[model samples]
Target: MREEGKSIDEAINIAGETRFLPVVLTSITAICGLIPIAMNPNPQIAPLAIVLIGGLISSTILSRIVTPVMYKLIPPQMDEKI
Candidate 1:
């Protein structure tokens, strides 16, 4: 987006909008896939699956919110060629 001459804010908004659906759908799919594992009676695998699901939920939410804020707070370092 930066390479396409979009301003940083515009680029971020566009990227975020485009990515929201895929990110959410992927997470939802993974969560659905893991539900059976999490529900299994096997103690070892069930705990692991539950933890993984939790991590995925947290990461998906955080990335959607924090990444854009961080990008805005920290300006990119662009190199200009003469």
Candidate 2:
């Protein structure tokens, strides 16, 4: 994107759109995993499910808020071009 002369913000927006489907799929998978654990209580297996669900939920929310801002704040280093 930098090579194409796109700004970081534009790149971030485009990248997010491109990556949206994979995110949705994973979110659904996480929720599906959560359901089985919720239905039958297993002390050991449940914690991992809870942690994954919590992380997935919070990170999805936070990243949607943070990623673009972070991209804007930290401009790409010229030496970091792929």
Candidate 3:
């Protein structure tokens, strides 16, 4: 975003705003996809469903909160872009 002349806050805000809906919808789809597999007592794939659900929850929280906080803490590298 700095390469596009946006300030740090502007960059973070734009990134967060742009990502929110897609991330939310993707998370919803992942959870929905896992539900049926998770509910069924499959000896083979049931564990995958549990792991995927946990991963989805973890990633959603990180993307929504931790990522923005990290963005605030980490400045763009000087050599990376303008």
> For model 2, how does the per-residue alpha-carbon lDDT over 4-62 read when each residue is reduced to its tens digit?
88877788889888877788788878888787785567788878877888888888777
Give a tens-digit lDDT track for model 1, residues 9-68. 998999899999999999999999999999999988999999999999999999899999
Error of 1 at 81 (Å): 3.0
Residues forming the 10-long window of minimal summed lDDT in candidate 1: 73-82
lDDT of 3 at 40: 83
Name the candidate that leads on TM-score: 1
Q: What lDDT does model 2 reach?
A: 0.79
Candidate lDDT values, in order: 0.94, 0.79, 0.88
* Candidate 2: stretches off by over 4 Å: 80-82
- Superposition TM-score, candidate 3 onto the true structure: 0.79
Stretches of model 1 off by over 4 angstroms after superposition: none
Worst 10 residues of 3 by lDDT: 73-82
- TM-score order, best first, reads 1, 3, 2
Worst 10 residues of 2 by lDDT: 73-82
lDDT of 1 at 54: 99
TM-score per model over all chains: 0.89, 0.75, 0.79
